[model samples]
Target: MSTGRARRALWRWLPPWALDAGLVALAVLDAWINLYDEGTPLIWSCVALGSAALFLRRRFPLTVFLLTLPMTLFMDVAVAPITALYTLAASTRNRPLLAGCVLLNAAASTLAWPLSDGFAGDQTWTLIQFVYTLATATAPVLFGQLVQARHDVALQLVEVEEAREHERALHAQTVLARERAQLAREMHDVVSHQVSLIAVQAGALQVAAKDPDAREAARTIRTLSVNTLDELRHMVTLLRASGGKETELTPQPTLADLQQLIANSGIETTLTGGLPPGISTTAQRTVYRTVQEALTNVRKHAPGARAEVRLWHDAQHFGVTVTNTAPTRPSVALPSARHGLIGLGERAELLDGTLTAEPTPQGGYRTELRAPTRPA
Candidate 1:
């Protein structure tokens, strides 16, 4: 249906022997037509030469064009000579050579007609020969050029489509990578907070237990929880690697502009402390994330519980806490991934900090975060 596919099919279906036989038959038919129309052996011999050249045109196009030129002067209207010129023009685009052949055909036809018998050197007869030569000799070459142009455009279109397909595939791969890295970060947050909480609760149990066996079991639980959290962090680090967010945070929010964060959070929160200047950007970012997660947890687990946010700085570390009073009525279950605190703990660890979350004895929740003021 399409030119490229059709050409491929033609190549597959036609053997060289069959194709050569077809071209030879076409040349003979053209030679016979000239022979019948002229009925002159001299003119017919010249026309036959042009037809015979057809078989070699594919291998020697310019030779075919030159060889067939003298024959155009022999016959008044020859198809074989025109076909030779067409094949040459279509195959090779040597403009000056083709122009010379066309001009020679016109000049020879116009001038040689007078040399024929029954010609009284009439200007009108010469004019008719010129028009016929120009039309018959040049028309086939023009048609060949048109076919060549169309073929070039078709090839160019195919190349452009292939380039676009390659670009699309690369774009898809980039998007998939970004999504995977984002998923790793989210998983890290959930896993770390939950595991850290397990460690903390077990630690408290170990401290309060009186039985030696109970204390030892509690200690084992805490150790396992901490060890598991360590392994999870290592796995997440590998997964998030090469995605720049693995090493440095973007859209970093700091404590200086934290009031806006608190106001927009839709929670009644207070800020009482500020960090002194010269704190590293990384630690400040960790502080910002810790506070945000704390407020988020307060809103989730203690709905309608008036919350208080406190911040303080010592020579070694800066501390943040979000504490809420006991809820009047039990908070309704909200759709939650409950991974916010895990992410928070990891963020604190990045800054040599600790995140502790627990139930207050008064039936409320408290989340505390501490990060080093100086690099460790």
Candidate 2:
């Protein structure tokens, strides 16, 4: 991977406790080197205690610094308290109070040791030693503050990155939703053309039928087909308007609308059961569309066939079955986009369901669907 990604991956793999352990090790090493140079047992013990306090710096930073500060003044120990002060400056929010106390202590230590009367060295060498002590004492605090500033910048970058990721996800969802609406409009248009043809034919039949039952059936078929065309136009308009501002939407047809559907069909269609219990609006619409598509296909390709629609509970799931026998006459030839069954299958899968459309041995067609009784 690239450098930035590599660093992020390594940081993710490394735990915070491991870094704390490394800090403990550094503090112990610094204190041990001082003790080995010219240290007595009592001084060594104090150095060890101060080094141990460094382990607790992140948890109780100010407390650890207070405990180690006194050790530096009298014991001549160097690393333990300096590292503690570095941690305090790096991690804590309060800085000025710590800097003031640290400067005062450095002054006291310089006066007590390097510039004391016991020093028989030259005044120039004493001045250099005082400068060295002041510089060394101030270095850690400066470095720690710089580290803190970098850490704050990293946090802001991380927050900006997360916000961008969330925005991208929402944009993707919006695009997918618009695509679905467009596809639905296309499907409606494809089916609406055939339905309008049936309405025109049925209007002709309504004028010629002699028996009361045949006339009434012909009238119902034409009326329902015209109604279907109107609904399809409304859907297309809604889909087109979706590209601009939001528009008022109508609720989709539910399974309850199938009564009018079967009545209006010229074929003798029998609907067996009402909608199953606990069916959501999504599944209800799926059921309505499944029957609508199947019946429409029967009208186009198997005109005057006997069809049956049955809904029932099968174990923990609900089942919808639409079956039609062979047509009495030859099937008509319309524009065949031929994706209706594929779309139905996808809709079934969306509800954790399955759809099977196949021809029967009697040269007929059948479509069966199974959907979960509960929403997934």
Candidate 3:
């Protein structure tokens, strides 16, 4: 395997001009071996011109093939005419034209030079020679057509792979939009109703309470309720839109939300280090989600485990790491689609980052994300 690769590498190092020159040299050698004994000045000139015509075969395939025919008549030279015929066939898609060229090559090879000598020969012998020459001429044409077909099939395979990848991306986006719409319906039906009742009761208490502190507390509750309701409406609107062109999800979480997320995680977690300010919002969100998913998994899979969330930065990059100790108690099985880590990995890839999750030597699990500090 290594030897084959090394040979191919060496072949690639040769320039196009060098390969063409080598072919021309081979054609010249063929002419010399066939015509060196009894060639006239005209026949020698014909051979020379035919050999030189191979240089321009790639650019003018039909003209080059025609140039080689005179030498095929005067001298029995194989290299120049076969190479020209192969070039013409490979470069053209006109089957009728290629068929005509093959017949012309066969006729030239069978007939004797000076025209009259061919008719003077035995008719049966001439017919037999023509059949043999015709069969030989067809070999290069078939080979050239095979090469062309292989090239076209390769291009089509590349296009098919690209289309399949595009379809997969569209399917994933559709699934995500459907899930968001379902979540929006749940929040509107359940959470909105409960919050509305809280706001109404708080308003009534503010109006009826006698003590100032009690009334003030009721007023605060009503105010907070109103704000929460407003935020929920905005979120529901965004989700129901299904990411239309006119709207985008906004106010995404950042590093500032890390502490609150950990405190509410219901796990014994310690946060260490800090990220530098001025990082992109997308990067910040990726960091937040990595920690969130890691902690969630620890709570579900590693029962009674202690977790550590660490934020660190270097000269070129910054990210977060979440690690949890092994489970201290048996965990209850829960139904899960198991797509959370896959989603986080895809998100990190969009920001030119990487996510790695694996078990540690101490029987714990670790999830880490590393991203460029200034992504393009």
Top model number, TM-score: 3
Off by over 4 Å in 2: 1-48, 101-105, 113-131, 146-158, 181-217, 223-376
Which has the better lDDT: candidate 1, or candidate 2? 2
Every candidate's lDDT: 0.69, 0.71, 0.83
Assess candidate 1 and give its TM-score to the true structure: 0.48
lDDT of 1 by residue, 1-376 (tens): 6999999898889976576556656756755665576557766666566667777877887787667665655544455566667777787667787777777767665665336642557878878878878777788788878877777667555545543453454345345546656777777878788889999999999999999999999999999999998888866654543222333344556667678788987677777766667677556666676677676566555656777778878888787877878865344344444445555665566566899999999988888888777742
In model 2, the Cα lDDT at residue 240 comes to: 35
lDDT of model 2 at residue 207?
93
Where is the poorest 10-residue window by lDDT in model 2?
A: 239-248
> 222 in model 2: Cα distance from truth in Å?
2.3
TM per candidate comes to: 0.48, 0.44, 0.60
250-355 in candidate 3: lDDT tens per residue?
A: 5667788999999999899999999878687667777887898798788767868999999999988999999999988555444455566766776677568899
Q: After superposition, how far is residue 52 of candidate 1 from its true place, in Å?
A: 1.9
1-376: candidate 2 lDDT, tens digit per residue: 5999999998889886776677667766766665566666765666566667777888877787766654464444566667777887798667786677577546544553323552665768757766776777688777888889888777556545544553454355355546856776675767877898899999989999998899899999999999988888767644532321223465567677878878886678888976566787668777877887788678767856899999877557887899999987544344444455656676687678899999999988999889778842
